[model samples]
Target chain A: MHRVRLGIVGCGIAARELHFPALVQLTDKFEITAVTSRRRERAEDFASMVKDALGYEPAVFDSYEELLESGSVDAVDLTLPIELNVPFIFKAVEKGVHVICEKPISTDIENGKKVVELSTNTDKVIYIAENYRHDFRFNKIRAFIDENTIGRPIFVAWHLWIGMDKSNKYVQTEWRQRPKHIGGFLSDGGVHHIAALRVIFGDIAWVSGVTKRVSDYLGDDDTLSTVFEFNSGVVGNYTVSYAVSGKQYFEIVGTDGRIYLDEERITVRGQREETINIPNQNTFKNEFEDFYRVVKHGEPNILGHPVDALKDLSFFEAAIKSKDTRIEIEDLLRSTTPD
Target chain B: MHRVRLGIVGCGIAARELHFPALVQLTDKFEITAVTSRRRERAEDFASMVKDALGYEPAVFDSYEELLESGSVDAVDLTLPIELNVPFIFKAVEKGVHVICEKPISTDIENGKKVVELSTNTDKVIYIAENYRHDFRFNKIRAFIDENTIGRPIFVAWHLWIGMDKSNKYVQTEWRQRPKHIGGFLSDGGVHHIAALRVIFGDIAWVSGVTKRVSDYLGDDDTLSTVFEFNSGVVGNYTVSYAVSGKQYFEIVGTDGRIYLDEERITVRGQREETINIPNQNTFKNEFEDFYRVVKHGEPNILGHPVDALKDLSFFEAAIKSKDTRIEIEDLLRSTTPD
Candidate 1:
């Protein structure tokens, strides 16, 4: 098997903690040939760690432009800050390299479309690395619904309440604390939920939402309560808070039964109650595997499609900006279409 | 203790099953003086049941107007269909008798405002019996919120999914099966949830909502997903479906802790986790006790206030009619004012 040459574009926490750990396991599929970051020392540390694990020295570049110019890689794993996502995607694609960028292709719709247009006009694989689409738990939930184990789905209730305290590693990140994204952590991290919803229920047609800025530590709105109406005529409630005590679950109640997805189990309640124990699976690993297949084998990409990520961001943006009005998701997308 | 003379003006399911069972226990507070209904046989059956329990032979009247004219009761408990609620309140008040009418005050704003005006003008106690406001479980929840066990209030998520099967007695009822009320069962039964929300979170300021008509058995929209913004700037999500499998819960997540209220217990997660086992209390009995206090002792009526029920109905109506726009609760109330 020909190993795809990979470049680690960011030496931030996610790159070091999430990506590198997952990449080291897929040695046959990917070879880390280069690393780059704003901080050269972090990039050197990342390359040294990669070299020690895979027994191959990698080139370290001070800038993403330099990494692209060096020609040391076939594809770049872009995990930079939110504001830098689209700009770097354009640079990588312009340099004729396969690009797998992190979630939220950009902070807003205009830049997100630029990636869509760029990917449309190029053969270089431009995949948006949204892990939730690749997350196994949500996949099980989607299968359960499709199997009619719970009958036809009538409604859904998703509750996410996490206290993003200073002790939490994600909360300690400076950009998250004062986000340049549309709704701070609400958009920066909320896209995953939208992706999962779309994965299970298809596209949302409309959203009526309310938001609150609860914690000063978390910039923009930290809490959102929304009602989503899908094209299939199913309506659901989503309440997410970053300033509260923790409890998380996604429930889909249907005509014959209900399916509940939590961290530990998938509970099916109907004529015969059943519990499906969720095995521990690294979602980032799953995402990387799919990206590898899409790049190497020319496989059809669903999770990595830039349009899917764009739809997720568009839904997130519409929800937070709804301001107590029912926003049509298609209308928001339509307005963003280049004239 | 002087027992207040009470007339039962409806002998349908609620009057027969809920009121008689509850009133029999409050013999020291109320006396069964008369009974009336659209069906005379049901009224006779109810009177016999009352006499069997209380050792008092109550008059069986064929019409509510005759019961009002009999002058044998100081107050009447109105548990008729939703359409008859406001009209009968007017009849009882015109006869110079006090009333404990069933929720909601009326089906829409115009008639609802009439009750508000009449209750405001009347010297006699005209109490609207919205049992959820008097339910002991909700009282405990309110006390929990007021005690600040959950720290500063942040957000809430309320999920109610019940499969209204043909075997269910309420679903079998002709009125409920084909409700004359707006939004069908979504309004008739959904009022209780609104009452509980108001009791716990105070008056809601605005609502953005979506509705879905899922079941053919359910007359109108049987599923509603709504985002409520309270006057205090706290936001919440409420999704209710009468067409799906049963799973009910109201969760409030705050800074210091969280409160989970389900059928069995109030689970509090905080510094020191606690579980408050909810004792089964007949809410009808509690509501009758409050009404007795208001009529006999001339005490201030909180739960039994007609305007409170009106507000609950107004909020329900606004949410169902919101369509795709955000409805201001106070603006809805202000529009119903007697000009």
Candidate 2:
């Protein structure tokens, strides 16, 4: 199969840690044809790393539009912050390039909806890189639920807590803490949990939440507990805390059993309980490989299509409204917010 | 040690499934002196079960007050519905009997607080049966957190979902589904998660939530999700759903590690991730043994203390207020409703 030429639109941590490293490993699947960052020096630094490691150097563009119009790349990966990437996605779709964007496609619901509509009109595939769904351990649990190994799910509890080092250079520059840019933790981190739950359980019919900033560093709240009522009548409780001092874990409970996932293990129980060891394979590499396959073969990856991404985005928008108005979000389409 | 004569109020599921069986196992620590139920048939049936199994015929009462005044019992296990249990607890306290009541000590905050105050005034011990905290898996995780195996907790995602059978005769009779009597799902099922989180984290600073009813047969809502901010700046998200079709699971994420627990197993992850084989021991048996040890030998069992029970009840009250007002609850004392 011919390699899909890729242009990355952000040079931040996600770009450095995930995209760049992943592109290097899947050399036969993808080529980094062009790169852009707000700071030319940072982009150059990233380009140097790619050149030194992969023995290939891509052209650099200070402007995202310039990179898109160059016509050298077949696809664009929007790794930029939500505020900047929302517009970039529309432009990429307009240019007829297949796009893969990071989560919270846009901080605002209207803009997120627009991105979904644009993708639908252009026939360009828009994939939300929700890595949690792609993680092998979670995928296994999802399969288990489908197989009814645990029986019917009555309730589900998910915990995703990661302590962020504020002093880390990547976290310092990220737009996550800014409510205007990323819609706080509920929009930033909370979206991942919301999307994952929707993927595992089904559609969320209603949601309500409380959001708060426990840390002094972030202007917006970093902590939130959101409840989801599924269309199947399953009840779910999720606690998302940024202030917790620990690693990440996810668990799902069913009538006959329960399943749990972390970085290196999946434990499940019901009529009988068992724990499976999950080898700590680099999840980012696996995710990128799937994205490349989808781009190359028109294969449907587990992250779902652009419309599915939009549905997840819609839930994020509703969660914010639920937090602000203290009302249960019944209808995503009817749910409105300030621009 | 002389055997402590026990009187059980409410021959409900908890009494049958948990207390009665456990009492049988700890024959050396306890003797079933009497049993009470609103219905004469149930009281007689329970008395017969005890008599047939133990070969000791205990008295039966149609009312709890009669059981308390029988003078044949030293302690009362108040397993009545939350609404009925609160008044029964006060009556037991007035009779100078030690009390072990089931969770959510009261549906109303004011009543729960009064129970706390009344216990403080009397010499009688009031142990609330919060078995989740006593469960060995949670205790192991809590010890690891205390030891900093996971580092400082910056974020936490906790979820507990359990599927229930609507046709189950025991569940059908449960008062937990009625909002007027038990404060619904959030009050009944949710308090377990709330109380557990409070014990592991700290006092809840604020809470916001949404509640909904999925089942037509129940008067109370079947689904709920609530966000809590701890006074220590730790933010948490809690979700509970009665409509889910699966098993029960709980997970905790910390700075350096993560812990996952279900009925069958426990897994912890950090720099090194390990899944431990947790034996499927009946937790209620452990709870009863601990209570017996404390009552007979003056041994310190964490859940055997009255103050801890009161604290769990206080958190239950706070969660209900947070659910009702759709606001962050800062002062649990002020938000409590009178009994």
Candidate 3:
């Protein structure tokens, strides 16, 4: 199979720490032939980092439009901020370039719907880069439930709390300090977790939650706790915050068994019990391969299409609304649009 | 310490398994001088069990009223079912016997309020048996937060899921099979957990939750998930069910650290990460001792007076109401009366 030539857009933390390293590992699947950033120095630095890692310096573009015009790659990995990424998808689609955008295709339903519409019309693939869906533990857990290793799934609970002082260094950036959108603290990270649930369980039929930013130091609401009802009759809970002590894990309560995952470990407790340290694989590698299947094999988008991705945003949308309206989650999420 | 004589009323599972043994442990501070049960056979069996366990045979009364009239003890441990317990509380209080009744002073706010008012007017101590307050790990966790070892508390999350099929033997009985009151699924157990949080954290000022009885076999609303706002400005989440996998624990998220407790284990993660296996002690022993302090030394009830226990009910009361009315928890719980 021919390598899928790719353009890495935005030399931000996500791109540097996540996608770049994954690209280095997927040398057989992806050729990162072009790169772009708003600042020339950032792009040059990313290129040098790539050279140090992969022993190659690919083309660098002053602007994303220039990269698209150069015809250096077949697909663009849009790693820019939420507001900036949607329009780039339109540009990539207009140029007939397949696109792999980060989670939450858009902050609002209107634009999110537009992305769905665009992807529907194009033969080129539009895959939302949802790495959690590709994680081995999540997949194994999902498979376990399907195989009746846990009987019928009943409840799902995921909780996380990490203080800003102890959070990722990117949390210190100016743009991130003030989220321009709804989900708050773990805004996009919220989308990622929701994606994981959708992958492991099924579509969320309803959701009820509360969101808060008790600290003035934070620009966006940094705390959220939500209860989710799956279309398959499973009830799930998720709580995340950037203003409390750190905890990162989730538990799925099933009829015949139970499963717990903390990214690094998978625990299944039921008629029998087993705890295994999950073997790590570059999730980005799995995400990109899935995208390639959609492009080359004419395979369906397995991670999530733009529409399925809306449910993740849908949960937090209702969460923000619930904080003010005090409305029941089922009522809030009853309408398809997560407005 | 002068031993405080006690008359135990009701020979049910809880009274027999819990309080009877607890009374034996606090023999230095108290003695089970008399006992009563509706069925003479049950009372006789308890007397024999007490003889075997504590090496003493207490007097047995055919009726609680007879035990009260005889003045065989200073206080009575009321352990009847929820509906029956309130009137007996009144009977015990009116008879001028100090009382150590069970948690959830009453199911309905009207009766619950009456218990509170009666306790207020009397000089005799009325201590609700909230054993969680006496739990070693729970108290230690609370003390850690008070000492600023975990900084200011920000969030609390407790979740439990136990399938009805695998639940306690009492679940097989008629009344439990069809809950007679609010706080669906395991109502008494629900009240117990809420009581535990009140012990470990603080009074839940406002609570918002969604509870459902997705299963038919369970008598009460077999599932509950609630978010609580403490008067201290801390937010907590609790998800519990008797229709799913079994888990029982809570997490206290503070600014500097976090504490996770699952009955037998206490995990503190923060500037330092520590997971300690806490040896389980008889929580009921500490509970009775605290009551002994109240009656023997005129100390104020530390875990809660009747009025304080009402707040725990008020949370579930609102929880039950939230299902149909779609009312905000803060609004539903704003008034002292759970209307």
Where in model 2 is the C-alpha error above 4 Å? A46-50, A53-56, A174-179, A270-275, A280-304, A325-339, B1-180, B183-339
How would you encode candidate 1's per-residue C-alpha lDDT over B174-200 as one tens digit per residue?
A: 777767676678778888998888888
lDDT per residue for candidate 2 within A1-339, as digits (tens), equals 398888888888888887777777889888888998899998888788889988988899989889998998888888887787668887888887888888777766556666666665776778778776666665677788888977776666665555466774534765665556444655676666766777677777665565555567654766666665677766666666565544444666665667777776888876667889997677677777788878788887456465556556665555555555432211211232112
**TM-score for predicted model 2 compared with the true structure:** 0.62
Which candidate should be chosen as best, given DockQ against the real structure?
1
The 10 consecutive residues of candidate 1 chain B with the worst lDDT sum are B329-338
Provide the TM-score of chain B versus the true chain B for each model in turn: 0.93, 0.86, 0.89
What C-alpha lDDT do the candidate models reach, one value each?
0.80, 0.68, 0.75
- Candidate 1: the clashing residue pairs are none
> What's the DockQ of model 1?
0.24
**lDDT, candidate 3, A1-339, per-residue tens:** 488889989989889988888888788888889999989889999989988988889899999999999988899998887877679999999998999988777765556667877877988888888788888877888887877777777778788766566355767666677676666555676787787788888777656566777566666778887665677768777888876646586777776777888757888887668788999689987888788888777898967588667656766665565555343322322221312
User: Against the true structure, whose TM-score is highest?
Assistant: 1
Lowest lDDT block of 10, candidate 2 chain B: B328-337
Record all residue pairs in model 3 with backbone atoms less than 3 Å apart, i.e. clashing: B161-B245, B184-B221, B185-B220, B185-B221
Interface RMSD of each: 16.4, 15.6, 14.1
In candidate 1, what are the lDDT values of residues A1-339, reduced to their tens digit? 488899999888889898888898888899999999888998999988987888888999988999999988999999888889988988888898999888887887667777877888999999999888977777888888888887788788888876687577878877777677777777777899988888889887767677787877776778888887777776788878887647686888888888888878989886458899988888889989999899989998778998788778776666765673643322332233222
